[model samples]
Target: MTDVQPIVRLAARGDGVTADGRFAALAAIGDMVDFARDPPQVVPGPEHAPPPCRHFPVCGGCQLQHLTDTAYAEFAADRLRRVLPGLDPVIMAVALSPPRSRRRASLKALKRGNKLILGFHTEGTHKVVDVQQCEVIDARLFALLAPLRGLLSGVLADGQGAGVALTLTDTGIDLLLANVTADRLDRIEALLNFADAHDLARLSIEGPAGTETMVERRPPQLTMGGIAVTLPPAPFLQATPEGEAALVAAVLAGCEGAARVADLFCGLGTFALPLSRQAQVLAVDAAGPALAALNSAARMAGRRIDVQHRDLFRRPLTPAELAVLDAVVFDPPRAGAEAQARALAASVVPVVVAVSCNPNTFGRDAKILIEGGYRIEALWPVAQFRWSSHVELIARFVRPG
Candidate 1:
């Protein structure tokens, strides 16, 4: 809590409960997780940044923002090594994307009356802080913080125990003002006008089901790899354009001649389209909307891709159903694919590339594939989210006799 306290750190500190019932290693991540709330006021870095937001260290959003760039990446690389111990591949390169402006989703704390308050969770605990300025937010979205504060301040009689949620993308902003009733639609609509009046490209009002509806669901227009793509408020678009390309490049490097490839849990085909250059892609996801978006992107790019909607978790595509896939890019959610991991390892496919955000799950699943006679060929640890104790990694495991 204070600067004088010596740092108690863990090399592979984790979050969440582990099998032994301890938090997952917070320190052992490719991202930064400083145990101290307020970063030391005296630490040195580029003095050019817009002065540190008063909540810089107190807000749990970004860590190590004050650390020098070189120092930060080294801190990140250590976490990557601990996470993916089996590959032992040299880091090809650490691509530093420009600082963030592309956060599309955020949760807020809520309050009411003299007690009205809606913001982010406070440091160390689940309590919420009345966030005024978020350094991590984009210029467009960041500017709305105060206006949103004022909007909520007037609309809500009191927000003592409530909270709000938000979304920001290239297009505009979305504020999920909580605790709204159908009777209050008029006042809420007026709030949307206020957001629009502020030159917000677009705004949507979302809340508990019936009480919430999109005032404007203008999906953001974005282009990637020379292909135009659009996404509803949600879908896993890489938060930064540079990070997206870097990740795609990593996936593509491993995907050469990967004929009849299966893109698991594919969101918007970041990997699928590029891989399709010399291969046929079968993109699968449970979300119909995301699947639809993928198909459109493929079409817009003049590339052919087969999109399937299915819950890969409950049921992965049966091995018999798989085409003659020479290689596979399995990008599943954090809870790594135990069933599919085993299935792919057992399959006749020669290569399996896994892109994961969680290390423990990746390690366990990689262990599964390795047991099935697959050998780790390469490891690519990506530091996309630099401020949290989390990192994304891509690994290629080749099947063995």
Candidate 2:
């Protein structure tokens, strides 16, 4: 009859799963589901809590808000456990960022007549949710939404839409507007006045001529490990400070006592700048703008960091070059570094730290290193993008003598 099937856990996409294998949305652990009917019905259980944000199951920003704190943390940890089984890797910690702590976000804005709608896209759809309040982004950033909508109403043409990427930097908010046009000079003036009124550190617009900076009161910067990195326009910044700290700490722990290190895919020198305080770090990445910014910051900070603008996938650091470094740290994008991992496997570097946002790719890379005589020592999972299936982690490996 399937009278009552208790939901035991949550799936990767935030859907609750029953012990017998039924999926239900907006269901949490300890919830009871009745699958006897044509469609299942979910009844909230003890672990279910009220979602803090008004927009839940609608706005795509958050997914697991209905889960209690304990359950939420468990869900994040399970993400890693599912990938690395029987390895018994040391679990250092599972750091979770608090609500309203995210420093960077990209939102969609569509102008419908005189009204301007601004918020995240609806779950799995291009339709905008028009969020009134967000639980995952900083309060300072959320406060700008109303004012931004007001300004966007005038900037966007009828039925036109734009994408806004907002980041909270050291100086102030850095905003990048995409698909926005200013046919008249007054539109440009309005943008300048808006930046002036809000004291924005920088404001850039993407039009037919490409991205053009409208205002820059000061260079937008973000301090990582005591080094000030000048952020490039729409550069990749860590979503949460807590998640970044966890990753840096893990990387530094793995890199302890090394005189020389290599940071591959080093975006803006997140780990390189900090490791430079002790070791000589050579930062490599394909991103020219990011490398240029990192190099400038290193020069300004008087740190011994060599920035190399090279695509690792196309031309990974060979075993000979990697052999010179005492240790290596690579934080590749979601698509893990396959060719680079193979190169690293053949290298004689004693220690290697792999940071990734995707568990599947991390596992594949870990397998390659393990087969090449590297021992997985520690694993630290970080829930930087809170309440979502997205997970970031740092795995430390050491080659036996």
Candidate 3:
């Protein structure tokens, strides 16, 4: 009908919003909606594209797959813009990773009678999608799902499920199965055979006692900044390589001429190892194993990266300690580095690059820094979790006189 209202934008949770403040599910920007019915009907628009994945709508992995590239980017950038309304920082183009680029994901594998369901949980529900196909993960990763289902079905009894984490490493896929038991000897043998046949780099299972390594065909390593670091089991890493690069580039650009830099909350030296090329870097994190791996990689490469195993949340570097560094870069987890940001605000550090996956926490931390006399110079959003509400951003801040 001529009275249809067009969806103007996508809300924070991936629902399309109309100018009249109505929300429609699975609708995209520019799509027309007929509000005459009790439930509005969405008519496809030029900005709406067919979702390539057969598992769309059913699979909870992605939400904005129906939106065009331009529309998707806008939704991500709008998140940051809305958070910092007062500032006009340079907003960089969204770095959207292509479909099937997700390097790591945790999947649920449940065995029911003769059938084994393996994939993401259903949208807002516990039901498994039993993914026949996926578009959000690497082709190599999706290919392994079928084999994983087959292998898991052999050991997982009916009514039982295992939390499976698969990560693509330098050598091969590293798998970690939680809530797994080897009470039956045959299951243990089957697991070993599966690892060998699939040439998995490492396979670890968790049971009542503790986590046990079933196979370590080769050390699962991730090479970053020319250093080969053997990652700890299921370590936190960038969801996509493209997103990591974008964050690294933003951090580097912000710390261009600094002589000494401190990488706070540095997990596995993602930025520390790379920033060390131009400046001496002090890498700090609470995870001892991660720091150990980073230190080992630096030593093997003959690079002197100062690694510290300390909890920043409990004992963030003080202003006196932070004053020594020319610049600082912090990539905190989703909860963000609130106390650390406060300390940085009080410090004499000239440059800071903040990377975060959670925009809300980022906004909170950014405000703390801004109040502490730091000016946001650049903002870049990396949509690695494509088509999802999840957004990652890198913000550059500089201390002004």
- TM-score for each prediction? 0.80, 0.97, 0.97
**Better TM-score candidate (1, 3):** 3
lDDT of 2 at 342: 97
Scored by lDDT, model 1 comes in at 0.64
Misplaced by over 4 Å in model 1 are: 1-10, 13-53, 114-118, 160-168, 173-182, 210-213, 300-302
Residue pairs that clash (backbone atoms under 3 angstroms), model 3: none
User: For candidate 2, lDDT tens digit of each residue in 256-314?
Assistant: 99999999999899999999999999999999889999999999889999999899999
| Best model per lDDT | 2
lDDT over C-alpha atoms for residue 176 of model 1 = 53
Residues 294-333, model 3: lDDT tens digits: 9999988877589998999999999999999999999888
Count of clashing pairs, candidate 1: 19
**Model 2, C-alpha of 98: deviation from truth (Å):** 0.8
Ranking by TM-score: 2, 3, 1
Off by over 4 Å in 3: 1-3
After TM-score superposition, what is the CA distance of residue 317 in candidate 2 from its true location, in Å? 1.1
Residue 257 CA error for candidate 2 (Å)? 0.9
